[model samples]
Target: MNKWEILNHAETACYQEEREVLVRGDRRWITALHYAFQDDNYLYLAMDYCVGGDLLTLLGKFGDHIPEEMAQFYLAEIVMAIDSVHKLGYVHRDIKPDNILLTADGHVKLGDFGSCLRLQEDGMVHSSLAVGTPDYLSPEILRALESREGYGPECDWWALGICAFEMLFGSTPFYAESLPETYGKILHFQEHFEFPPLAAAVSAEGRSLIQGLICEPQERLGAGGALDFWGHPFFSGVHWATLHHCTPPYQPTVSNGTDTSNFDVVDDCLSRMEALSGMRGSQPAGAHLAFVGYSYMATGETKDCSRDTVMSTDKQQSGDSEGLIRDNLLTESVSEELPKPFEHHLVLSKGPAGHVHGDDTDLDAAMTMELHRQLQEAEQRSRGLEEEIRQLQGELESLRARRLTELNIHEPHLFLPAHRLDATGDGKLAPPACHYPLVIRLHRHLLLFHRVWRPGVTGESYLLVCAAGVELQAWSRQQSAELS
Candidate 1:
């Protein structure tokens, strides 16, 4: 596959996703233009022309590691992209350092979709021909390739873990000279780091990330899992909005035009690869037909070959009028292997069809209004419940205080019944009770209290209690009346 091929697939994938997942955003948006083929067999992707180079180059100019907070910002965006692709029934077969690109302000954009796969809706079993960068292959993928079994998106997670590890440590956890050797290490190896010794030299947040990224695919973050991982304590205080807005805390070192030009061959090869890979630039090919057509020889015969040679085109199908190339021979050909193209039955189209472009302000205002309405309703309900609770609590407290005071006036700062002297000694001389001393503070609030007394009233014995701010002030004695 070359640049032209890659761009065609990318355009197809972009259009397909536009219907289901991709949408206009608060900032940058990706739109696919028609593919242009270069004479040198390289496809020049006239994409949005993001000025920021590939993520690998950015990491190279900076240190091998990024701050955990900064990394979370990038990861959050990646997770969103992945989720969007996933919802459209696609899985990014290749997730690696080379595939992620950053814009001028450091916004990470997922660029290459050359290895995405689209699954069947029925949840039946299917096989994906292993097509991804080697180091990131999951253990299940390695097992499937080696054992000739089925594998799924779990393989992508394996790659994500390796990618995360490389970001921190500058290299993959498993590396080897040959494919088999690399797969062996990934499957059987135990990941043991120097722990606090090595990580202590790094930030605590960075250390936590390394631990998660090197784990087995089954145990690693998947889908919503990455969001939770980014929310960890290591990412505390990170300005997510600023980071998303392309305001990186630190800038990556810049490479001159000369250095970027050196990768012309790379760009060419990727374009060609994209065309031949037969996947939508962002997803798997439309159906199993292209795969089936590529799987069998024109004569409908199977061929046995080595892994490396499998990538080369054989002359057997070149002369055939049908232009069909059978690529894989291991699986048995079945009737359901080939399906009709998606557009024939789905009846759906994507992207803009007209030029009514000035509705952004209206849309924003509508969203704001809806949010405001919901907030107002929630606040009103909360206030009403709070007021009711306060009123009930106040009544209950008042009743409890009054009853307790009447039962125990001897207690400090409690109200007591009014008492008078019995002059006859027969307890029948109830005379008119007269005036009492009243204290008014400068604040114009009355301070009322009760005086204590004895049985006979001939002798003087007493106790007094005063009231203060919402509580009992103190107990004091002015004079004493002895008991009869």
Candidate 2:
């Protein structure tokens, strides 16, 4: 297809729509706008008009690095954001400055889940997918295409750490000239990555927090989820739950509701969209690809969980932009609304960079450098060995699970991933028991169910043979055949 024909497919724009509807609709101040309406060639999202612009623009306005206090405020919002989505069983594969936005009050919100991963309720969220902005990818994600295993929610924390680093240093912690060099830095992060002289003024507590989150997946911070990470010394005395309530560092200058003064792209996009309703009859009314049902949004009447939107779907209200914009905020039919800032800490200061070696002194800087060198050497020796062990372990688990399934034997010792299981009996979670050979609907997607039986002790390392409801019996048969 020609470029024009391809652009009409709604795929690019709908990625924004789908993610916002599924993930960002979580009722937080740190995300994007939502579905508005659609035309034949365009799908309009009824998103809040952020007059202050996106984080990238704001960062540039701040001379590449936001004030330490502002960065802290934004980072806290985004941290809570990712954590919320992870809890909702969604993984935002893409997290970066470009996807984050600011409101009139400098309230930061992360947008664009077009590249999100929805974890299956069957505890099969482990994915071979390694898609994300290269600068923000975790080491595991940086090499996921190699071994194809699970990284889970830890990957988001890594990306979050990169954002934290950039907020302080005006650039990513391990950025380089080319993709290869960038990957190399991430892999050998302990050695190649170091705080620049500018970061020296940052608090030791803050620097350690970022360092902890950016480490290897196993050693990365947030082992106990956001709850644990919140307690880190880096954020000590900083109120997290109420940070949203704090007054933003820089408030924007805007008066009207539809003003696009801050976002040049939005202004240009709308100008082109002036032809959407054929104001000049240059385009055919029926010659369009973007549909309301197909795209994500707030159609006055047809809005439902099943996404029953289509071209023939009648408009729920008058065909006016103001009406659609109003619906985005006040309409009960849509799932999202204008995000309001919360109240909390009023003042914060930049943190010192590194204190792991000792006090924040010049002699301690030498110690810090030496300490990092030693850590790198240790990591290099242990790097390649992990892939080998992980491969062998995966093979063993598959064999054991398949054997038990074939014999129709239930191994009580085997359990699914702990996150996917329910807790009982001395607070231990293992096998998440559910009736087998079943199909159920979550949100709107149908899911197929199956169980992986095996002999294991961790109770959190098992996998349930559940897949999307493509063909339950057939899929199970194929799995068994591979084992046989």
Candidate 3:
């Protein structure tokens, strides 16, 4: 009988968008986001059962780079997934091994829209701020932040390139000791990087695809847009229209929906919370923020959670915080009731042993000593990059993904043209220009929207739409005088 208190409208907008995207029921790459709801206090989301867990879990099981044939299948599916996301006019900023979940039947579904950015409908794409996993963060995103500029969906392709590298090599392409160093390598990698032996074994064409995607923003393979990346020879054999129908290269063996063997501790915890939906408690003692969404079965009916909850849920007594947190999706633990973080990270020993330093007999006997010395240093940097990959993985496990929509949360632009009045002067201000679509030149200041009721169906039923704007005239005047 507990509940979550809802506050910010923008946060709800994000949660709703995520739910809607999933509910679209696109079989090619979409996951099932069953429902979203809210009481006076908390938001609840129910998603589909991906019993096979995530790609990262499968990687850990293999103890190294997955076989190239299997990696190819996943990488191709990811491309199709990215295509679907773009078609929806959103950029999934976080597309890594963890976010790509697997079904028991062995297909991929792209979930986790917490880091998504919706582009403006009128062809004017805007970038607010940088976000996403450090290991997969695109170079242009980092550069845009440094230059105080904006970015677009191209960032996702760069990340796709990183995903490809991790799949084939079990390490990132630009791994470094620190964030800045890693970013620098990303910016300069085009002129310098080459496929290591582990990756080269996949195919020269595959390496070329990565090289093209992992370049500077202007020259990036996906900069031309989604179709360009799909056309790459790396996916030469792929028939996009039928990928969903074809058998997945590796299908997870699922005994039941409750299976957690493929998942890590963090994923297992969430899976456990999801399983424990029945005894879902009342509003926690002091929590306020709540998430909300709308969901249904493919038939468009609200699912019968009563029966499902009783069957899938755990018997453990519900904790105070668990009511609001229907799903433990964040990478970091949100409360003490959650299990401790794992200490060990699975690593790939799939390094190109002796690939860099071939036998001296193969070296030209007449070759200059200086050339040999440079080769040795290059090998060392490669090794350094791999070690740094391990560190980045650790960092991924430690960080928490923030719930609030950090970008443009405040309505900085305060003025709109008089003729474009959606409000009839109840004096309430409009929402943020960067967020709310606009036809007028933007002016920065405070404006609040007012809700007014009017008869729609002989006043029988109603819509709770904001009907007017009531700008705070006196405060604006006072602030203007102070600025002077």
The lowest-lDDT stretch of 10 consecutive residues in candidate 2 is: 305-314
What lDDT score belongs to each candidate, Candidate 1 first? 0.46, 0.58, 0.57
Order the candidates by TM-score, highest first. 3, 2, 1
Tens digits of lDDT, candidate 2, 1-484: 1223334543332254354444334545444434545544444445554556788777777888877777766777787777767766666778898887765445666676666766666532455555678889888865666776666677888888888888888899888899999889888888987889987878886698788888887888755566555556665545554455556667655444444565646535434333444443555444544342445554444332112111111232235332232233333322132111211112232245422221233333553565687789879878878888999999999999986555432233322233343344254544543334333322234443365434543343223444454354454556556656
Q: Give each model a TM-score.
A: 0.45, 0.53, 0.54
Model number with the top TM-score:
3
lDDT (Cα, tens digit) per residue for candidate 1, span 189-303? 5753334334455576666665565566556656343334434554554432222333455443323212242111254552314343343455434432322211111111221
What C-alpha lDDT, on a 0 to 100 scale, does residue 88 get in candidate 1?
52
**Candidate number with the higher lDDT (1 or 3):** 3
lDDT over C-alpha atoms for residue 336 of model 2 = 32
TM-score of 1: 0.45
The numbered model that scores best in lDDT is: 2
TM-score of 3: 0.54
